[model samples]
Target: MNPKVSIIIPFYNCPYVDQAIESAINQTYPNIEIIVVDDGSTEFKEKLAPFQENIVYIRKENGGTATALNEGIRSATGEYIAWLSADDYFLPNKVAKQISFMMRENVEASFTNYNYMDETSQPIDHWTRPVFSNNDDVYRAFLNYNAINGCTVIIKKEVFEQAGYFNPNLRYTQDYEMWVRLLIEGYKIYYLDEELTKFRIHKESGTYKHQQAMQQEISIVENEYKPLLKEYIARNLE
Candidate 1:
């Protein structure tokens, strides 16, 4: 039996949400569920009317992306979880390719390369991620910089059960914090070399609008994970 994958998209008032929903609905992979959590957007529900029947829509009060994701995960019934931001999108074969790779490699968590696109979804450039020789190197690399983009990641449901959910308190680096926890708990993260996700960069993006706050959160998370990272590095050097 093919394992079911749940694609969770958390959105606020982004106008590109329909594009994201369409991307999820059109995936080549069978046995996939698409869930969109509307995180207290002031926009009218009419904006989602077109895709309402196609997606599992959940409405809740204003919460950060982390909370929205957690809510969506709680309602997910799939064995695997894929997170796609409302402003971004997945390629048609994304779920198929990532699921096949995970099954073939027997890994629980994985991410793929992605292209950076403009608000109109025009490709600006592709991210050339570093190649890791092994899982250990992948974790070590994350210690220095976050190499995993949440939108490109497909994680097994059990990984979240083990690592816990995203940090709801973290307004900026929630995904990064969760990735750090997953690595610390010995979860092996695989990177597929294919560009299967498109990340939209716009002026309204959280990374663009809250640059200083994001940096501060990153620093806090780095310091919190410092000791664990140092221990891993020390053991690797021995």
Candidate 2:
């Protein structure tokens, strides 16, 4: 049987949520369960009405993206979990290709390169992530720069059971923090060189709004994991 992949889209007040939902619905992969967690949006219900029949919609009081994602994960019933941002969308073969790669390599977590798009969904640039041969390299790369895009990642459900969920307190760099934890816990993350997802860049996007905060949080996460990374490298070198 094809493994079920749960695509969790956590959004606050994105007007382009329909595009995101449509992307999930259009995946060529058969066994997919799309869960949309609305983080206290006021007017999206009407917009979501058409796709309501196709997706599992959950509304909650105002919370951060991490909280909304945790809610979706709690309700998810899939062997694998994937994340799609409200402003971003996936290619039709995104899920299929990732699943095939994961199964063939026997890996629990994997991420792909992505195309940077404008608010109108027109491609502007391509983000080609670095390839890591092992989990240690993933950790070191993350410490230097975040190569894993949250919207491009497809992780096994058990990896969360081992590494835990996103930190609810972290308003910025939540996904980065989770990646560090997963790498530290010995989860090997495979990188697919294909650009199977579209990452939209807009003024209202979180990255633009919380630029400074993200940098500060990334520094904190790096410091917190530096000692652990050193020990792992030393042991492996010996």
Best TM-score goes to which candidate? Answer: 1
Query: Tens digit of lDDT per residue, candidate 1, span 1-238?
Result: 5799999999898889888989999999989999999999987456689986789999999879999999999999999999999999999999999999999999999988888889888888654556666666767777688878899999998888777999988987999999887777667789888889989989999989999999999999999986887786677644
C-alpha local distance difference test of each model: 0.88, 0.87
Estimate the overall C-alpha local distance difference test score of candidate 1.
Answer: 0.88
- The sequence of per-residue lDDT tens digits that candidate 2 reaches over residues 1-238 is 5899999999788899999999999999999999999999986667788997899989899779999999999899999999999999999999999999999988988998888899888878554446666555665676478779899999998778767899998887889888877776667778888889999989999899999988898888888986786676567633
How far in Å is the alpha carbon of 199 misplaced in model 2?
A: 0.4
Q: Model 1 reaches what TM-score against the true structure?
A: 0.95
Q: Estimate the TM-score of every prediction.
A: 0.95, 0.94
**Count: clashes, candidate 1:** 0
lDDT of 2 at 189: 79
- Candidate 2 local distance difference test against the native: 0.87
